[model samples]
Structure formats: structure tokens, C-alpha cells
Target: WLIKNYDYDLIKFLQWTCATPMKLIGKQLTIIDEQDMICLENDYSQCQPSQNSSIIK
Candidate 1:
């Protein structure tokens, strides 16, 4: 619907959908609150391995 109505690129839209943390109820996607978004960002940032880490390299 969004693609047809707004002429959005399918790949970009899917990429955005995957990158943003949101609730998927059926076919509808709901936005996460600011607090949840901040928490998710912090969680991912803390878990990232350093570039110099042997495990990643």
C-alpha cells in the first residue's frame, strides 16, 4: 500500500523497516517510544566489538 500510494522504493523501505525497531502487529508496523529506542541504541552500541578485537578481525 505504501509503495503504491507514495511510490516509495521497495528496497529502501524494507531497509528502513529493518533498521528501525518497531512492533509488527499483523501487517501494520507501530513505532517504538523514545525510551525504548534509546535503550535499544545503547544496548547495541555497548555490544559492538572493537575493530582491534581478535575475535572480529
Candidate 2:
């Protein structure tokens, strides 16, 4: 619905759905790659979930 109504892309969707909700409760998240490399929000598309990649608090 957001994609159609608000023209949200993947990054915006994640920020609104994940980060925004977390912020509402005072929590946060960090995405890491397979090598434990931190994935910045600008590179959110590269943070695909795998056996090693993770979303941490």
C-alpha cells in the first residue's frame, strides 16, 4: 500500500517499517554482511539476508 500510495522504495520501506517503529520505542538496528562488514543505510540493498548476514540491535 505504501509503495503505491507513497511511492516508497525498498530503503524507505525498511526505514519506515523497521527503523521508524524501532525509534518509536527507542531501539535501533544495524545490518551486517557475511564478513561481519557493516552495511550502511545508503547500501541497504546490499544487506541481503544470508547464512551469515544479520540485522543486529
Candidate 3:
């Protein structure tokens, strides 16, 4: 529900992967194309529980 509504940067993320921040790959792949960036945004900032003292949102 939450993960699906965000903006996922598949290209940039994959590029970042296996490098330093993520390290998804090593010295195997030499490039990243459009297919590699299949997914994109995922903003969960709006995921907040209700504070009505009755039920959780």
C-alpha cells in the first residue's frame, strides 16, 4: 500500500547499487540500461498512524 505509492528511482538506485552505498554488484556488469531500472519511487512519508485513541490508522 505504502511502498507502491512512492517514486522509485530504479535507474539511479541500481547504478548506486553494488558501488558504495548499496553494492548490488561488483566488477561484473559494466553498464545499466532502462531494463535495469524496472522499478521507481517509494515514498512512505505519509504512513502515519492515527492518533484518535480509538483505532490505528
TM for every model, in the order presented, reads 0.22, 0.20, 0.22
What overall lDDT goes with each candidate model? 0.40, 0.39, 0.38
- Tens digit per residue, CA lDDT, model 3, 1-57: 323764445435533442322222342343644354343344223223333336548
Residue-level lDDT tens digits of model 1 in 12-35: 444334444333223332343333
* lDDT of candidate 3 at residue 31, scale 0 to 100: 62
How displaced is residue 53 in candidate 2, in Å? 19
- On TM-score, the stronger of 2 and 3 is 3
- Displacement of residue 5 (Cα, Å) in model 1 is 20
Error of 1 at 50 (Å): 24
Q: Which stretches of candidate 1 lie above 4 Å from their native place?
A: 1-8, 21-57
Residue-level lDDT of model 2, residues 1-46, one tens digit each, is 6446663345453543433322123322343222332235665554
Cα lDDT of candidate 1 equals 0.40
Q: Count backbone clashes in candidate 1.
A: 0
Off by over 4 Å in 3: 1-24, 27-30, 40-57
Root-mean-square deviation per candidate: 9.5, 12.0, 13.2
lDDT of 3: 0.38
Question: Number of clashes in model 3?
Answer: 12
Q: What is the lDDT of residue 30 in candidate 2?
A: 40
